[model samples]
Each structure stands twice: as C-alpha cells, then as structure tokens.
Target: MPSDGFRGLVYGDWHFLEETTSKSKDSHVSSNYAYSMGIALRGAHYKVYPELKYDSVKPMLFQKHAAMSINLRNTQPMMLQNVQMKAVITKQGVFSQKRIFSVNNSKIAPNSIVTLPVQWQFDELKPGKYKVQVQVKGENDWNKLPMTWKFIKNIKVDKKAADNINDKIMRKPINKWFYISMATGGLMLISLVELLKLLLTGSK
Candidate 1:
C-alpha cells in the first residue's frame, strides 16, 4: 500500500488520467486537455514485474562486492520491447551515500522471464540498514503505452564483515621489488666471490 498523496484524487492510489490532443495552427500548436472525474481510467496494463530473489530478511555482509539477483517476467500476450531495469540503494537515513545499478535495453518474450545482472559494492557504505529500490519498465510492441513496476527490499550490513574488509583494505601493500633487488644483489656477490677464488687458484 502506497498512497497517491492527500488532496489528490482522494480515492487513494488513483490519479486522474488526462488525455491531451494537440493540433498545429500556423507555427503554433494548440492543445486540448480532456478529463472526466467520474470516468474510471484504466491505467496502462502492466504485464511485467520484477522478482528479486535473496534472503532479504537476514543481515548481509558488507563485502567489497555484492549482487542482487533479479528476474524480469513478462506475462503479456505479446512480447515486451525496450525493457530495462534500474536499481538504487540508499542509506535509510543518510542521503550522502548512494549506489545505483542499471540493466541495459533488452527484450523479453511473452510469458517469459529474463534474468538481470545487478551488482553493487558496499566497500564505502557504513554498517547500517539500507533499502534496495528497483524499478522495471517497458512497452508492449502493440500497445503504444509504457508500463512500470517497482519493488523494494530491506537489508542490513554486518558490522563484523565490514570491519574485516576495511582492515584488509587499509593494510599496507607488500613491496615485491625490494625482495627481487635483494635476490639479485646476493647472486652477484656470490658470483664475485667465486671469480676471486678461481683467480687465486689459477695464479697459484
């Protein structure tokens, strides 16, 4: 249950649909907007929805990389066109940090499901609760109108995992060139000593 805000269509979740007709008149266009309050507006028939599969009830590790597996299903009579999904993750109370994932333009067959590749990083996120908001939108090949659906999942970040990941990230990197240089110097010293011993033996 989502609301359409108060004082607007008062019927809750109902939006007055407006049909606009425009005609060109001498380099200018005149528009006629028609609306009837009593008339029920049959909104765009949504034939597609997203199903995000994961254990959202449990806390998740705040790893460097995380993925939200989702599948888009089309249940319409005709195939869907230009289907795309956008996923957004924002801190519950904080507005500064945000992560976004996008699904490129794709096509879904009628009565079929399309898996989407959605991955996000939590390396920079603080250990707290967040909401993953996903939106799937597409158009029917024959219907001319676009349809959109939305979904949300609540998730919590594990503090222990976050601490471990941050500790690993903050650790200093090892210097491999230092070890290589030391090995080269040791070999050269050994070769010089052997050369000196051979010189003495030859002279004697």
Candidate 2:
C-alpha cells in the first residue's frame, strides 16, 4: 500500500467507507429531515462502513450494516434543544425503515461524539449498487449531510444464503407443506366416497 509508488489502485471489487456532516447552520437548517433532529454547526458527524456479509447464497438478501456513533456533545455547552440523529437505507430512490436516537434529555459536553450501535436487517435489496444516508435533525433546524456507499452483490454467507432458511419477511406467508397436506386429504376423502357409492350401487 505505497501511496508514492502507486498513485491509486482503482478496482471494481473495492469501496471506501465514507463520512459526511453538515457544513453550516444554514445547511443544517435547510435539510427538511436533518433540521428536525436538533443539530449544530461543528459537533455532529456521521460515518458509514461495511459491517459484514449477511449471507452466502443469493448474498444480496441481506448485509450487516451500522452507522457512526452519535454523541450528545455535538450540542456543546448548551444542552440539546430537541436534537436527535437518524439512519436509513434506500434503493433506487425509495427510503426504508429508520433508526433514531436522541440527546436532548442527556447531559453532554461540547465536542464529544456519541455512538449508537445499529445491528439492522434489510430485505428486498436487489443485487447492485445502493446508497445509505444518515440525517441529523434539530427541533428548530435541520442538519443534512449525506454519506453514500457502494454495495456489491457477490457472495452470501451460509446462514443467509440458504433458500430454506426462514427470514423475517418469509415467515408470514402460508406454508407450502400445509397446502399439500390439505390437497392430499381432500383427494383421499373423495376416493373413499366414490368407493362407498360404487359398493352401494352394486348391492342394489
């Protein structure tokens, strides 16, 4: 990894983790969602990185992911005036579920970073490149800075790769086995009825 000899190594299988934060109070307030979380100019920050490979088969089914730490100190000497941070996942242009945290009720000094651990499960994610963004909002204003990441749908882990493995989304559907059993029972009942009818007609 020599920076001098190798100017840069551009490869398709590689991606860089990223961090994004609000630049100014105006920028913060301008963000509709971020502004609502209670953010200030200098103390807040967000980081994004690959946590782990979620599964092995159809590896694209899920991915281990998390967000940067959230510190109450971002509000500084002045306690948070209705402040919180939120993280979300999106594909194509649609947003998914969000995880939210609050600092307004806590005591934080200025310039400190607070972190909330996120172990999230994502479904309906196609195999391709996607973006994950975090927006910090203040009750009075919005701080919107976006950090984007590239996800490559390659290999999935063993636990998640198995098609038969039960998933959060898959558990709700009716079982295929149940329907097969029901159909078999109906056929058996019909056959018994036909046999009984034939016996009765013969006796007549």
TM-score of each: 0.40, 0.27
Cα lDDT tens digits, model 2, 1-204, are 224332111111233444454567555542222222333322223221111111211222222332223222242222222344443333332542443333333222233344433333332323323334444443211222322222222222243333322343232356899999999999999999999999999999
Q: Give candidate 2's error at residue 201 in angstroms.
A: 7.5
Tell me the spans in candidate 2 whose CA falls farther than 4 Å from its real position.
1-78, 84-86, 93-127, 139-204
Model 1 ranges off by over 4 Å: 1-64, 75-78, 93-96, 115-117, 121-127, 157-204
Root-mean-square deviation of Cα positions for candidate 1 versus the true structure, in angstroms: 19.1
User: CA shift at 185, candidate 2, in angstroms?
Assistant: 4.6
TM-score of 2: 0.27
Error of 2 at 86 (Å): 4.4
Tens digits of lDDT, candidate 1, 112-187: 5555434444343367777777777777555546767777777776787555545543334589999999999999
